[model samples]
Target chain A: MLPVIEAGTGPFTQPPTINPAVTADWLVAFLQDEMRARRSVAKAVIGLSGGVDSAVTAFLCARALGPENVHAIRMPYKHSSPASLADAQLVTDALGIHQHTVEITGAVDGYLQLEPEADARRRGNVMARVRMVVLFDQSAKYAALPVGTGNKTERLLGYFTWHADDTPPINPIGDLYKSQVWELARYLGVPRELIEKAPSADLEADQTDESDLGITYARADAILSHMLEGYSNEQLAERGFTEHDVRLVRRRLDGTHWKRHLPTTAMLTNTAINEFYLRPVDF
Target chain B: MEPPVNLDHRAAPLRVAIVQSKPRKGRYEENLRELGEVFAQLTAAQPAPDLVILPEAALTGYFLEGAVYELALDARRFAADLARTWHEAAGGATVDIACGFFENAGGTYYNSAVYVEVEHGKHCVRHVHRKMFLPTYGVFDEERFLSRGRRLQTFETRFGTMALLICEDVWHAIMPTIAAVKGARVLIVPSAAPGRGIEEDDELGSIARWREILHATAAEHGVYLLYAGLAGFEGGKGMTGSSRVVGPRGRTIVQAPALGAHIVRATLDMREIDLARATLPLLGDLGAVLPDLLLDEELPLPRGLHASGH
Candidate 1:
């Protein structure tokens, strides 16, 4: 097989280290400014999914927007793990933020009944979309903006539903990698159990995130982090990564390029809509 | 006066390390420990750096609000300990460290920078500069908490004569111009400027402005300029760290990215200063106009009506 990594210089030989306290400060400021400029809202609504990404995002928003203005929504289906709900409650209670429990089973089942033969992919997508809808409803009633918790890893590997989990107007954790999410979570004083627990999409029965993706977070993050920092597959190999691991990650990263960008428009005019008359959000 | 020596001869490269320190609020012990570790790493390397520069407010950190006075260091006492620590880490090796801190002298606190030269268990407090311009507008309130240094003096070092400027001091052209005129061949600035601006191409507007200012002054004076910035998040402000080293010709020798902690090292030739000053003689022009810049006595104003606002 052809060498996966490009034979060239890479971003760094060592991994990137994040200072959580500093990252927390940056995230809080970013959330406050983005909320005021983008939506004109002082309140934020975040989904607490017993995951590090959501927990960090929720904590940052609460810190930035204040606990009184922040609301944590727990949206679990009938098949979702009870542990997940308990873990989310742990987060809400610790932050002293408002909490709401809205079961997505009813909303998801309504769509699933029309397609009884739908597989795991279809059912998981429906659940994600349903939770998003319920979160938005709460956002309107509470006068808060929904905050996205989907991280860079999931986005890069195309692990999330197209427009379901990725629909939030603002996100503080989107730029961080999965490993970085863990680091930030620990730094924010998140409970040790939450950080230690195996990551899962909570989409199907007996499902684990790494098992389903056929890649581990340690390996995946190492490959993805260096690659994002300008390292090619060939460079990663030179830095002590297995050839097979680098190939797998690059393939997934290369495959997800279309998903990362805005929908390409067929240019029929000299002034494309995205190219002309643009204004900064703050402006 | 001693005879002037040829600056173009005896060619040896000067190595400088500019650290973008990630300092936390009100954590003096941690910050000191971190600096010690930074020193160990630098000294353990082959051909250790000639000088290491750290960011302003590195001891107590910026944005302390009201707790700055309590955490301020006694300049004389702190320098003794810092010199000992430097001797232990880089002993038998010569390395000068320049860092910013809050200094408490005679019950009065001031934001100051101290330069220490250490070699084989001997260290000296060569120069101490109190910040002249204490900004009090928009994210800066130094004047309310600390006293300002009334003097700007340049000191001589083994490598060359150098000057130090705290964060906001470099924003004004007068500061750099004064240092250059005071016989400083190399000017160092330690800053803790918060990165504030809309995201565009992932570039910071404030960082860009700093680069431009440093470049203009270095080129005009034909001097080597090194900038060391603090990087971290504290009190809702993101401290930007885009430290850089500019040559006498104002060309960037090496630079680090924004918003990250990095130890930047670059080799600079001292002869470049003479080459640049020889080519572009702005210093000579400034020297000729120095007399006109001063006044022996206040001038009398002509009798005129003081206008009142409508």
Candidate 2:
């Protein structure tokens, strides 16, 4: 069951809600159709992070492509919490999907050794990219398509590592906000422990996503949704949102526009890939 | 093209099959094969449908952008191909198909729908309705790629006088009114509406909005409205597939599921148009005042004219 957030209560109170059942059915069909739109890819390879986003994605994939065809790759670093790995295992076991554990501490440290002066942000980026490397390799090894786990909130706020978590060719939940992902996760019967846990990239010790982003997913999602609807900052403040949180979300959203799109290409002709010579991904 | 058999005074019901199809993007032959399978299933039914309707861009998936030029087929060739497929599946069975496709007319490309009558191994192009309104806002960019159609007219079918309105055409109020005024007893709307807005309960906001349009148009014109919607995904955008048939009384006769490929069947009694119109008399009233309304439109307004003056 999902919480019913009433409208006109407060700024963080009216995050967009979804019909989880309809969303799940639509996404399952989407996964099946898009996975085989261009080719005959029947299997999906997902990086299981034990978080609501990835867990919800895994459940959808298991339903779209049969559990036997879904490959859940759990790549954990040395400093990653043991609880995260356990939760991921619980999801795989419940779904009866194939699971692979690849410890990324060695691979991440192999590149970070030369950058001893790198900060936590840089180190986390390296770990995220390394996990992606393992994920893509496993996808190739298993002959399965890599499915992205990034949600719309992270994509809009630029919370994800560019070219790492957002590199997959297709994403089932990319359009869903993080708050919506939680609602879907609950609807999909994800483990209660995982759903109740604080969301984290698990790149470092005690680093929750809210603390790093300076705003909760619930609050940020509401602000982002309203802003996308053309709500002004003053209007948002009038609607009971704190000025500080609104500024933080807007700044992150505006500054990371590049992360949401492909790399800039210098246009020299009448037709350019994606810019002028446009074709839908399925096309 | 052979002329349709006159059935203006016929009181028999028209059996309609609305195929909520999911066309593989850029794969015309594959979609044709799949449609053949659907035709075969329909042929096996005890009471075969007189007409089968497919969603907008049923042969080539929606959201084609520049690829519309590549996938578009001339009306004659498209009708012939459909005739061949129908002949292979149903043999001597005769069925009318109203399907949306990218059309190549001379050198211009248009988002068009064709109403073709297929029998045995032959096909006739009853009418071709190029989409008048090419939506260009939000996720849509049809106007940028395909040329807009210029005419809005109804034609004779085996069932009676009918009109075809593509997805966005029905969104405008005047389109359906004009079709009704032009003596369309039934309105066929083939759509490729993308699922959007999750705020509504148990239904997508877009689908709910479409239902409003369908019900209002059907009730207002006292005409049977058949809407066939495209199902499946194109670049993550899911086309909502709640294809439906609305009777003249504004009640849904039958509807497909919200997603995936499914066919919905409905038997429409053409006499219901007369019955409903006799009860409401709205279309009759509109027709009576239409000439006066047009004369009013032709005359220029006086200076400083206002509603108070009127």
Candidate 3:
């Protein structure tokens, strides 16, 4: 019998699971082909946030293009958790990849000082985008392509700041859900502390992802997977998920549909890009 | 048309090669160049393949969307191109090739496969099969871009009667059934199936499903089944590459790896088709009642029952 990774408690009689070994091989091939063959780039640069998603991406990149070719950049704001940096360091040291620590506090505050009364949400978005800037600039300096670390769960829920966390040219983990990423993190031998810690955007102090979303990744992933399979809220409730959890997941999924796509373009001409005129990304 | 070679004394075992290729999306010229290089290498091998089968959209990658029109070549021109490449590489070596590509038939476009006999630097277009089923659901918009083919045809080669089916064509049972009834002893399927669904198996869900379908179809029809799968990623969607050759008894002869570019070969004896039919005889039974079944399909629905459920 094939080994299955059991995602903890949910309405699912059989928990959603992936074969991490197969997934890792496929994802590494994806990175190698997308980077070396399609984009003609031999090196990759990723924003290592000391989180499971980014750490998994780093491991895949290091495997795809050797550790010497994969570059990890940590861009931390002043209030960013020190443990985040330490955890990220654990990955780079373990993999023997090039590591760069760029402080984004000065860059972020220079713009924030202009809008002194910006709220925490706005501040977080700025920090995320500043990290994006640092990551992309480093990519240019290192002659590498910027790889995205956003997971499918965050992408479907629209939890990421637009044009920031999702701005990279390619992402190996974007198709894997958050829980699946954790499974892959374990398989790839990511530092256990990073995998075990609460997932956070780390935009503000003590901002755990589950607390902000009001649903655990395990539960949300179960609901999302079932919903994508064309199950209704009634069906989900029948399957034992609470109505409240189902509605919240559905709302976030439906409301954030726009976040998953390119900007809406006015299609005055028949040849408007990404609309009437369509082409694959690799094309 | 005259037979390309002598047909009477053709008792030799047919040697076939399935090239699990990774065609670059929308880069037709580059893919042709790479294919030419593969052809050169195959030609240099000691026991070179008599027939080479490549996956669907072997000249241009699958998932071309609107760019299918830009990369499509007419059948005659495509055959000439392959023959020219072969001539330059091997200098008048004879080999038959079956590969899929987007076809430009006049102004209309089709997802098509062409069989060409490249002999002594000249080529003959044996047949071109256009895909009948254009899956337009999730992750597929084929119907929006190309027209469907209307006919199911089986043609004669030196080995025997053979039929070619594109990816979605073989998904429907009727396609292979009709081909078998038309006297095809060999079935060639060129597919660009995307790897999808992670389940309880080590293989992708798509690959597992395909394996079941291929085995059943080959066993039922009592024909040698050759499946060529596309490899590599097209817009992040990886094509599952498990190119295989299945015997008439539905047993896998040789299978390629599931991820990368590869070429898997197998030698087939035509006598196996006879032995499989003698053992099971499923194809004989189906052929006996096929004409009546076709007539039954033409009849109207029963009283109080519409085609769609009320």
Ranked by lDDT from best down, the candidates are: 2, 3, 1
lDDT of 3 by residue, A1-283 (tens): 1111111223363336899999999999999999998888999999999999999999999999999999999998899999999999999999999999999999999999999999999999999988998999999999999999999999999999998999998988898889899999999999999999999999889999999999999999998987875567876786688999999999999999999988887889988888788898767
**Local lDDT at B257 for model 1:** 70
State the displacement of the C-alpha of residue B226, model 2, in Å, after optimal TM-score superposition: 0.5
Ten residues in sequence with the least summed lDDT for candidate 2 chain B: B299-308
Predicted complex 1: CAPRI docking category = incorrect
Q: B41-157 in candidate 1: lDDT tens per residue?
A: 777876678888888887567888679877888776667767766676667787778888888888888888888877777777888889999999988888898888989988877
TM-score of each: 0.49, 0.51, 0.51
Q: Which lDDT tens digits does candidate 3 get at residues B1-310?
A: 7865446423467878888898777878888888888887777775778888999998788999888889889999998988888788878888889999899999899999999998888789999999999899999999999999989999888888899999889999999999999989899999999989898368888999999899999999899999999999988899998899988889777788777788787767666687678778999899888768766745774534455556
DockQ of 3: 0.01
Give candidate 2 regions above 4 Å deviation. Answer: A1-283, B297-310
Question: What is the Cα-based lDDT of residue A72 in candidate 1?
Answer: 94
> Whole-model lDDT, candidate 1?
0.81
Q: Which pairs clash (backbone N, Cα, C closer than 3 Å) in model 3?
A: none
The 10 consecutive residues of candidate 3 chain A with the worst lDDT sum are A1-10
Q: Over the stretch A1-283, how does candidate 1's per-residue lDDT look in tens digits?
A: 1011111223333344588888899999899889976668999899899887889888898789888888999999999999999999889888999999998888899889999999999899989888889989999999989999998889988888877788898889888878888999999888777899999999887899899888888778778876774555765786688888889888889998887767888877767676675666566
Worst 10 residues of 2 chain A by lDDT: A1-10
